[model samples]
Target: MKHLFLTALLAVAMPAWADAVDTLKRFVQEVRSGQAAFTQTVTSPDGAKKRVTQGRFEFARPGRFRFEYDKPFEQLIVADGQKVWLYDPDLHQVTVRAMDQALGATPAALLAGGSLEKDFRLAPAEASDGLQWVEAVPRDKDSQFRTVRVGFRDQALAALEILDNFGQKSVLQFSQVQSNVAVPAERFRFTPPAGADVLEQ
Candidate 1:
């Protein structure tokens, strides 16, 4: 759980420009569920290397997602609509928080039924790497990220670049994104392991 709040916020982004808005609406209506493999690189705002984590993710819309970290550490974050459970296997600890508190104005809430115009000040960015990009700055003063960029390839979500307040950036690139796929119900259901410490925030 390197950056728990920050990780929860890497959900989505969109700008009000015609093309960007169209892309967001199309995704909201069609790409309701997905699973993908990801490579995430975290760097200092000054371009210094922090760490890299690779993992697979499975998510369902309207507020359900799970992240499984497999490299550099083993951890998991699961949201069962109402609550979010973060498990740090190496520490034998689990942290739980209500969905509203955990997601705030993060990208997770955006993809899970939030509207860009309502929650973020979206700005269109010049297209790059065959993807249309939008920068999102949260309307909430207390958001975990300073700004986030969402990239879409042909209206399909491709990656997220998150800049935390302290000048650290984490980039998550998704590949093998399968939409409308079946993800087992139990994926978002978490039970703390025996002897693990549980902290409720």
Candidate 2:
């Protein structure tokens, strides 16, 4: 019978890859602090082309984070655990750096900060759309998004799919996700809107 339907399709795809690697190890270990509302897409690498944006985010793990980009414009990006601001109120501009020199292992430092198996090398990624995927890869060697695909649905963290190294692709899609709540320490503090135009390093 065709090897029992290929062993029952690997027993239902190996328990959905062990529940999407236990929902991304319980989403970076119990979701310390989070807030979300996002929808981003920027593809271009033979996939025709795309560009959509809408955001509102906040986070506070070991480092910190905040991004508030409304609709197809307006932007801001903070980090404040050492610095990494990037505001652009219609190009009035403000850009700083030094969050370990601008996010070391990238993917926004593995989605806001630290210790994912000490810099990532995870796996288990299959299901799509409905979510449940997880694949990180960047043991740091000057990484600039070479692979990172995190997604989960019921367990939270809606989606994310960076993959760059010339093959552009960035597809984030989170919505109303609020975990651990209570985030406000100035939302990662980025104060700089007086005539703008500041650039540090």
Candidate 3:
């Protein structure tokens, strides 16, 4: 009789505990076994501001990642736990920065840290404008973006919408996501060509 009562109480309390913030935290941990291969689409601002590139991503824990753009151009961004390298073969340019400083207020930090509860306040995922939205506001103003709205279907991450200070919105939709794959060691490391200009930004 006591077991039955406890089970019923827990069932009633479970949904309340599975809040937006908690869900994000759980998802991060679920994907943290080491690596993932996901595609990203970055849409530039309005009026044909720039090219929309589709890219493949490889990510490993403890600050390592690779972004390889495919369409429009071939470019790569790699972070090897200590330094970040952005290389564009067409432009023959390489940009390097310290990893910690480069990740300032970026979504990668949230994904890599699994610390959503520390950085964000959660509200209900709303349905407005004929779309589903989960609103998340950063706890710190220093965060690069003002808000991150994760769109969902059946509680899976369907899309991520980021709003910057200028009110510009960048939305990323992830497809064909394979989590916990064994990423190659070379993907996270970068070597610039001898003649390419290396700018420290």
Candidate 4:
């Protein structure tokens, strides 16, 4: 009877575990465009410091996306298929890098790039907080992140948690998610202000 009960328990749990992986695969393959409001919290390695920022993000697959940070400060990150742009309004600086070099094995690549299986080792993570989770570890040995976990609520993306090599953790909670919807092409395009210092990498 004990063995039978254990088998039954595993049977019930297996599909849910599979759902987490399937959900991520479906999201990557089917959801071509998405926009959302997000709250990002970054915690220090020592747990002594925390910073929170709110932002809006829009992405169209195959290497195009934009993140606009609106609260606590103004910052922007944009990728336009060819290059990635990071803009700091207060500092009047814009940093540019080739899109391929900028996104390798990063969380942005996982969400907004193609070829998921090529970049990361993905697996179902223990679900928690009413969400199914999938954890992805970069296959690249030099990736700055230790692991990236995406959480889904009812098969919709709800959260992303990233742990970096330095032990800092960042959690992004998404709201007002609109998936597979048309996002403007202009959202992914970036032009630095006239006076901003442009640095290329």
Count of clashing residue pairs in every prediction: 3, 0, 0, 0
Per-model RMSD to reference: 6.9, 15.4, 7.0, 5.5
Overall lDDT per candidate, in order of appearance: 0.78, 0.78, 0.63, 0.86
Residue 8 of candidate 4: its Cα lDDT? 42
- The residue pairs in collision within model 1 are 11-107, 11-108, 12-107
Lowest lDDT block of 10, candidate 2: 1-10
The runs of at least 3 residues in candidate 4 whose Cα sits more than 4 Å from the true structure, single-residue gaps closed, are 1-12
Of the candidates shown, which would achieve the greatest lDDT relative to the real structure? 4
Compose the digit string of candidate 2's lDDT tens values, residues 1-201: 000011345548677766776677777778878988999999899999898999888888877988888988988898988988998888899989888888776766776777676677777767877887878787876777788888878888887888888898988888889898899798788789888889897
Query: Which should have the higher TM-score, number 2 or number 4?
Result: 4
Q: List, residue by residue over 1-201, the lDDT tens digit for candidate 4.
A: 000011346537776666777888888889999999999999999999999999998999998999999999999999999999999999999999999899988988888875677788877777799998888888888989999998889989999999999999999999999999999898898988998999999
Clashing pairs in 2: none
Please write out the lDDT profile of model 1 over residues 1-201, one tens digit for every residue. Answer: 011111212334323234654576677668788889889999987886789999988888878999899998998999999999999998999999998889767867666545566668776666788887777788888788888888888777888888888999888999998889999989989999999999999
Off by over 4 Å in 2: 1-68, 76-85, 88-93, 98-100, 109-118, 123-129, 135-149, 152-158, 161-171, 174-201
The positional error of residue 97 in candidate 4, measured at the CA in angstroms, is 0.3
Model 4: lDDT of residue 87: 99
Cα-lDDT of candidate 1: 0.78
In candidate 2, how many Å is residue 113 off?
16
Estimate the TM-score of every prediction: 0.87, 0.33, 0.74, 0.93
Residue lDDT tens for model 3, 1-201 = 000011345436654323444455555677652433344444444534533566776677767877787776888988888898999999999999998788744666555542455556655454543444556677777766787776544445556677776666666666666667777888788989989999997
